[model samples]
Target: MNVLHLDTSALGTYSISRQLTAAIVGQLQRDGVASSVSYRDLAAEPLPHWLPNPDPASDNALRDEAVLQQFVDADIVVLGAPMYNFTITTQLKSWLDRVLVAGRTFRYGPNGPEGLAGGKRVIIASSRGGKYSGGPAAAMDFQEPYLRTVLGFIGITDIEFVRAEGVAMGDEAKQAALQAAHATIGELALRKAA
Candidate 1:
């Protein structure tokens, strides 16, 4: 399986989202699938926001075409995110802005809008400071829902979310959330994830 992992949490090694993504990736490998990794560590080597090149005649299309090709070939995609200001971090959004190019991930047909990529699954590992798992606040969660909408616009409809929330509350809350995330990983984040 070709796995494209986009780890955007600025906390880097200390990030809970990164840890969960690692554990999930480890689980997949342990389950015996030969996985190829494409890692994008936003803090280390961030994906460019994809502004037009300096030369007036230089086309953005050529530059973005190369990156979109990478998206088309991956079988599974993993995104590691940390909540910021009740939403996703800027790093994650920056990467999305690069890959979700028009005519690459999606295009407008004569009939209607059409997506190009297919047959790939997306896994999002998120870490939040407080509780937004359920209730009215859940609807306010901009991270997962935004990701779902954008990726789905490119025809990536199969998505699974594993969150480690309330980690900042205390040791007890952190442990409980981590355990729950791990359990979800065990149940769903397998080699051949369904």
Candidate 2:
């Protein structure tokens, strides 16, 4: 199977999302679920955000096509999505803009919208500085919700998330969150392989 791994954290080695995504990818490789893997670090090499008025034949189209091809070829997609300002990072958004193409990932049918890119599994490693899963902050969480909406729009319904929240609370909280995420990855990655 082909796996596409995308890292969008600017924190590099200090990024919890990156750490979790790495472990998940490693687990997939070790379990023999991923025969080939393609890695892309959005923060390190970001794609240009498509503006409202973009040149159709611009050089960015080539790059966008390549990114779209990667998404189309992968059976599994792993993303490192670190929360920034209670939402997803700009780097990840840019990558999403590249992949969500008309008539490719989705299309407008006579009745309504129809998604073309179905049957692919998506796993996200999400990291947040504070607790956003519940309480008042839950309403402010645009990270996972937005991702789910966009991915589902493209007909990708099989999605899983490994989350590490409350990392900025303290070292103890960070460790606990990381540990929990790791345990989740262990179970999820194995289950996915099966």
Candidate 3:
């Protein structure tokens, strides 16, 4: 399988989402599920903010098309998405803008909007500073829900999130979250292998 692995964390080695994504991709590689992997560190080399229109032959336009093509060619996509201010990073959003193009990934149909791209799996390594999965903070969580909405809009219904929440709560909480996420990754690999 072709795996597109994207990391959008500015924290580098200190990012929990980055660690989870690396471990998840590594597991996929070791389990022989991934035939090839394409890695893009968006934090390190971020795409320019999306514009309404650009010259067709411009370098940025060409790069955007390439990014969209990569997404189309991949069988699976792995995203290291850390919640910033209760949402995704700017870098990840920029990448999304390129792929969610009209007549490419989706189009307006007689009924409504229809997705042209389908049948791909998306795995998100979601990290948050505090617990947002439940309790009062759940309403404030715009990260995972936003991701689900946009990806689903493009017809990707097969999505999974290996979440490491409450990482900044304390050392113990961070460790526990990581342990749980790792356990989930193991289970994911086993399921894929099956």
Candidate 4:
């Protein structure tokens, strides 16, 4: 099976989301599930913001085709999405614009919208600087909710999230959150086995 791993954190080595995504991909590899893995660091190789009317011959068009193809072809998708200010990174959003095509990922039926990109499992390694799962900041969290809505819109309902929150609180908090995320990843493996 093909695993598409996308990392969007700008911090590189210091990014907890990146670490978690790597571990998740490693676990998949060790489980003998992923026959091949494709890695894309969106932060380093950012796709240009998609234009409403794109030039078919432009470089961005070629890149968009390749990006969309990767998403459509992958059996599994792992995303390292660190909350930037409250939502996803612009780079990741740009990538989404390419993949969430009208006749590709979704379609507008007579009743409403229907998603075409189902059956694939998606795991998101989400990292946040503060505690947004609860507290007053919870209402302000647009990252996870937005991702869930958008991915669901594309028919990706078999989704899992490994979150490392309150990382910026302190060293202890960071470690604890990371440990929790790792535990979640382990549980995901068990679920996959079942």
Ten-residue region with minimum lDDT total, candidate 3 = 52-61
Which model scores highest in lDDT? 3
Q: Local error of candidate 2 at 172, Å?
A: 0.8
Model 3 TM-score on a 0 to 1 scale: 0.98
Q: Considering TM-score, where higher is better, how would the candidates rank from best to worst?
A: 3, 4, 2, 1
Q: Which portions of model 2 show Cα errors greater than 4 Å?
A: 52-58
TM-score of each candidate?
Answer: 0.88, 0.95, 0.98, 0.96
Q: What would the per-residue lDDT of candidate 3 be over residues 119-156, giving only the tens digit for each residue?
A: 99999999999999879999999999999999999999
Question: On lDDT, who's better, 2 or 3?
Answer: 3
Between candidates 1 and 4, the one scoring higher on TM-score is 4
Clashing pairs in 1: none
What is the C-alpha lDDT profile of model 1 across 106-168, one tens digit per residue?
899997877677679888898998989788789778887888888888888989999899999
Quote the lDDT for 90 in model 3.
93
How well does candidate 2 match the true structure, expressed as C-alpha RMSD? 1.6
CA RMSD of all predictions: 2.6, 1.6, 0.8, 1.2
Error of 1 at 138 (Å): 1.5
Task: State in Å the error of residue 36, model 2.
Answer: 0.4
